[model samples]
Target: MKRVTSLLILVTMYFSIACQPTLEETNSQLREEVIAVHDEVMPMMGKLKSFEKQAQEKIAKLEQEENVDEARVEELKALAFDLNKAYDGMFVWMRQYEVEDGDKSPEEVESYLKEQLVLVSKVNEDITAALEKAERVIGA
Candidate 1:
């Protein structure tokens, strides 16, 4: 009975030691992955924040101009519609990253996300131009 008990203890100790490294390795990999994700996501968040600030400034200006040019209202309406469509598309692109981040490999997902940055930047440029044109019309 004593030998059986001792043998059982030794086996348990061996298994525990053998299993520990696998768990630690998995934990370490997950930590690295999380850090990588943060590195990628933080910059994009900053860009989005800057874009939001610019948008807010434009909207404030637009509100100030609302009473100035009653005649340009139709043009403003079209610009607003275009702007909304562009922004909705941008939101969808961002959401796609959120959905695919875990399922796809990081490199593959990031490549696709990079394409979205170009598209979003282009849309932002278009919106900026439209806002500027609208403001000019309002000022006139």
Candidate 2:
């Protein structure tokens, strides 16, 4: 009888502890979601930067050459269309995730600002890379 009672107590304690949520688990989940959004959107931002640089280069080439490259302009415009579509799609998912996560609270907002700042920094590096490529392509 004593052994049965002890076993029951042990099982109850194990179940209770297993059901409890840990701070680490919650944080890891949040981090996973944030990383997923970053992964989803960062590439789109890079594509935008690439399109912007390509458009700038085409504009410069059209300016410098005696005859404008209508084909390059059309190509750039097509890239712009694709870039806009990608940005819109990525942003829709991002906003939905943010809303569902309820990250609009002051503290959450502050955290988001910090994370976004880091993301912006990374994107700026990508933009710079695109700009360098554009400069090389345009001989400028």
Which candidate number maximizes lDDT?
2
Question: What TM-score does model 2 achieve against the real structure?
Answer: 0.38
- For model 2, the stretches where C-alpha displacement exceeds 4 angstroms are 1-47, 98-140
Local accuracy by lDDT, each model:
0.53, 0.58
TM-scores for the candidates? 0.37, 0.38
Cand. 2 Cα-lDDT: 0.58
Q: Clash number for every model?
A: 0, 0
Model 2 lDDT at residue 32: 67
Q: Which clashing pairs does model 1 show?
A: none
